[model samples]
Target chain A: MNITPNEYNEMAKKASPGTKSYKTIPAAFLVGGLICTLGQLLNNVYMDAGMSKDTASTVTSITLIFAAALLTGLNLYNKIAKFAGAGTLVPITGFSNGVVSPALEFKSEGYVLGLGAKLFVIAGPVIVYGITASAVYGVILYLFKLY
Target chain B: MSQRISKDTILLTNAPSILASAAVVGKKEGEGPLARHFDIIYDDTTLGEETWEKSESKMQKSAVEKALEKANLSSSEIQLLFAGDLLNQCISSSYGLRDFDIPFYGLYGACSTMTESLGLASLFADNGLLDYGVAVTSSHFCSAERQFRLPLEYGGQRPPTSQWTVTGSGAAIVGQSGKPPYVRGVTIGKIIDMGIKDINNMGAAMAPAAHNTIKTFLQDTNTRPEDYDLILTGDLGKVGSDLLIDLLKHDQIDLSGVHQDCGKLIYDLEAQDVHAGGSGCGCCASVLCSYILKRIQEGVLHNVLVIATGALMSTTSFQQGESIPGIAHLVYLSDSKGS
Candidate 1:
């Protein structure tokens, strides 16, 4: 895209480096932090539901993915995505949730080439590396035990 | 076409045509963020407008009332109402202004609404039919989020490139060549599509459109960078704003001393947690309502150009494998003396 010199001239004023109020700083920080805290609380809730550490982690992931998937489908998740800042992200659940939401969103286009394929558009590599790395790690641990 | 007075001109320039103007802020009530920002309180909470369908109507009516009060005009005096919003139906702007006593036109231009409204309003003003006209635009965090990415209660993280939609609305009243702050020059934006498909990153999607429009405006007007006091882009936040500077360098144009992206100017990325910046029509409009107009009142700026950028993509459009197409409009504000 190109811009004219006159347009550049018009934009110069009011373009100075400025500062926001001190009040807004803390409020945004607190709100964003609170959202993250809730994610941690959800993980704790899953742990106390009679699940082992490993199972609890899996359940948490599943819960995040499913909840995000539903919201993505209903077009509600994007609203929270706007506010709450990294609270909606940062968590491991955010990854799968991101992947599944986009895929499910495009599902109506047809399953074979659409749903099945697009489901991994963003995180396909992560899933691939995840299984591969876990298998390799398990073998290494077993060999150490044998030694 | 006589150069004399015109009825069409009166219909176009009047502020009575204003249907509605609504603002939705993200801050909880009584908690003012930017003291120097705008002269209004921010609403911090989830907003469910009874039904999503009625949201725009509710916002527009309220905004129009506020604008009318400020302009000291009545709705019956309006001949046409031009409005826009972030939603598909422009529900917040359209439905909000539906029952008004005037013809209605709806537009969707993402965050560059102030320029869009001014540009369109000026057209009617220049045409010599309208007397009073009003242009309004709006956005809401809760509404836009649910429609675009996640639910209000859904806990998800945003990438570094994501821009926060300013939860607010802004309205402007244009009349038949009256008063100090009047519509002056308008640069119609051309569609610039760079084939970028990631709707998640709007700055990249819109930077080219803004850059292209700015380039065109300068060429068409035969003006240089120094002619105006400032050149503003609609919503290209920090990352995209930097990229624009780099791109301008290639064109042998230096905007180092005079450039601002509304998204960047509206909020502090670190403080607001808006990664790239704020992207919404309100980003530009609110800043103008709060800052630029005040400066104009104070005579700090002589000539100003407001260019609003838009990412022409919807949730459905992006999901369908369509690349984002961008557009921008340029409106020039100058002194009546033309010096």
Candidate 2:
């Protein structure tokens, strides 16, 4: 069926059955609490698997990013975003989702430049700053140890 | 050129139904949607004026009546009627005001009509050329979308960057200085054309225009981001608003604290489903009339810079492979100054 722009706009004005919640405030709390619980579990699992504190944190980050990318690929992330509102955005997982979603979206434009770089446009600076700061801290620690 | 230009003062302001009904639609299939009331109503059954040729006059007449009621000035007392709309030949604004017996200055700024109209009217009012003048602009979703995008029945899913066209109208009256509220300063709008061709992606097209205009206004006026309580853009949707923020950051202009895009502020995402949000001349007009104007009157925001932007492209022109040339007009409103 050829739905027009006005028709599309009109249909959009209608509430979607998927995102509507009767007990919105409680639903928000529940969803947010569950996401946090999963994050805690992932942190424990990473430590139990023999990874150091820093390594476990990094591993959790990678795992969360991959999961978000998978959900984005399945078109489920957008749906969840609709339901959770800010809930989907509060966790480290949301940031991972943000980076991975755009990367996957631009995949069709080729891997070398499009998918590889455009995906990290918004979050790239944070990653760069993080690595640089960590390197500086590592150098400081080594010098202190020598003394 | 026809003479008889004089300064005038705005007696009243009206922006009824400019804000679309936040109808909880899917919840109830059929229910009388709540109304957003205003001072003037031209038609009991219809929204505003019927046809495009008659729309401008309808708006002008309604505005004149409202202004007259407030300022105690009759139709003959006003020297000129300055008005326009988002239409070819400005039929909606011009023809409707034809019977009002006043000189007319027809303007077309796509959606930037409100600011442009107010600016011109205020200039005349401030200069003492005319005693009272009325500036009006409007946009009908059915009329505008058909002219710019697809037909009303084309049910294509909106991209996350798309905006909804508002079916609304707004009118403001400016006169030769007034009490409490008056025209403080008018920032002349600068046109910025990024030469973006894809009308389907208005966010990319108009974002640059908005960024450029905001930058120029701040530079030319020597006003900083923190100068005004609100730095409102016309109709840049969610995507465009985000892009505009990034662009502004390049110039060391961060409006993150006190900036709001009119399109995004009017509707709720879950309720309206207006993907990127709302657009069109009506988006800014209705917003200006209903929300911003009300706040200005209530003394919530001390100073406001209303910047209305437009994607200057038609469907026929786009089909002919022409790019969308965007434009934006800026009007600074404050209670501190008189006309």
Best by DockQ: 1
Q: Please list the C-alpha lDDT of all candidates, in the order they appear.
A: 0.65, 0.62
lDDT by residue for model 1 over A1-147, one digit each (tens)? 344434432332223222333543454466557645766677788788877787876776677677667766676755665554454555554575567764664554478775678677657778899999998988998989853
* Tens digits of per-residue lDDT for model 1, B1-339: 112122111112222122223333446211224444454544523344554335535654665777777767788887777788788777777667877767878887877767888778767766765777778787766567767875344445566767888766667766664445545566666677767675667877777777767766676666777887888887888766875676577677777678987788777777667778888776777666656765654678777778888887888888899888888888776544242
In model 2 chain B, where is the ten-residue run with the lowest total lDDT? Answer: B21-30
Q: Over the stretch B1-339, how does candidate 2's per-residue lDDT look in tens digits?
A: 112211211211311111111111111111112124344433321334444324434544454465466556677876776677677777767666778888889888887787787777766766667766777666655556545653332212344556776555666666644443455554555555555665655655677667776777677656798988998988887766776786688788998888898777766754767777777666676667656776777788777878888887776788899777777777777755522
In model 1, the runs with Cα more than 4 Å from the true position are A1-147, B1-24, B28-37, B44-48, B51-57, B337-339
After TM-score superposition, the amount by which residue B242's alpha carbon in candidate 2 deviates from its true location, in angstroms, is 1.2
Error of 2 at B160 (Å): 2.7
Taking chain B only, the TM-score of every model is 0.87, 0.81
